[model samples]
Target: MIPDHNNRDAAATPPDALRVVPVEPSLHRALLRLRVRPAQRDRVGSMADLLADVTQCPGSEPMAIMRGDAPIGYYRIDASARSVAGRDFAQPARGLRSLFVDADWQGRGLGARAVALLLEDLAVRHPATRLLVLTVDCDNRAATRIYQRAGFVDGGARYHGGRCGPQQLLLRALP
Candidate 1:
């Protein structure tokens, strides 16, 4: 079982036992091809579109989680000068876009770790930013839980016409 860091003492043990590294482009594409549940097949296309857009955008940044030199997962952060979903999104507060790990790498807390890393990198790059926002499927309990663990709170907004049901807005403040 994964140790609960919140309840454990500082010297008790190291919180994360696994290593997560940034994703390389080739490995990122390869890892993305790994199948999730049959119902999630549509995620592949959506993720692909986001990746392409981020790649083409002049200011977007993408990060990957790796076990050593091999990529296991990746996520993207997109900055918009204007509001994205009716919220006043200005400089620094990047939108958390595509985030996915290889099917074989799920359930290892890599998702949370990957997000933590992404937030850390963003904080370093954009010191003035105070918020991170993302949209997940309302029905994706697993993804919601991961985001919550990473300090994201429900923003009470939704986007329609996504494959994974209505998108639920979530946001968190950076340290």
Candidate 2:
């Protein structure tokens, strides 16, 4: 399990209280059941579709954001630099895709915590990844704020590659 060291009381909390782990065969079914709010359906898309995508895209890792033994969210790390930044990034980077907490588990600070855990996990899993890039829907202020608070910076340019319309391009340098 990945630890949530960003928390002030991280030492007080169990190391595995929240984390991101690869979607193993045993957790596939439960991970597929995770869903976002109705309004967010278009932003993140379905887990089945995203899972299938990871299989087709080489170096893409499908992961689950877990709280104890249950999956509360899901996301993918794409090692292909062109898959996300196009010509924006010129160095080794990873793309953060399909990140969302289950609707039932939202509004409890889990999303932010999950992102923090993901950054920590990436440092160990992909030591070569220096930059983390992602596109957040421009209208999704809540998610934008969360990403910003977690240290993702807006590049001030909109990425029009998303099916849900234009998205704000955000980047973060991984430690």
Q: What's the TM-score of each model vs. the native?
A: 0.75, 0.88
Most accurate candidate by lDDT? 2
Clash pairs, candidate 1, are 21-66, 23-64
Please identify model 1 stretches exceeding 4 Å from their true place. Answer: 1-35, 44-50, 81-86, 90-92
In lDDT terms, how accurate is model 1?
A: 0.66
RMSD of each: 6.6, 3.6
lDDT tens string, model 1, 37-116? 55655654455665677668766666655554456666766675233354665435667766777777888888887787
Q: All candidates' lDDT scores?
A: 0.66, 0.83
Best by TM-score: 2
TM-score of 1: 0.75
lDDT of 2 by residue, 1-175 (tens): 3433334454565644887778887888898898888888888888888888888999898888887668899989988756876754767788888899999999999999989989988888898888999889888899999999999998777988777888988999876
TM-score of 2: 0.88
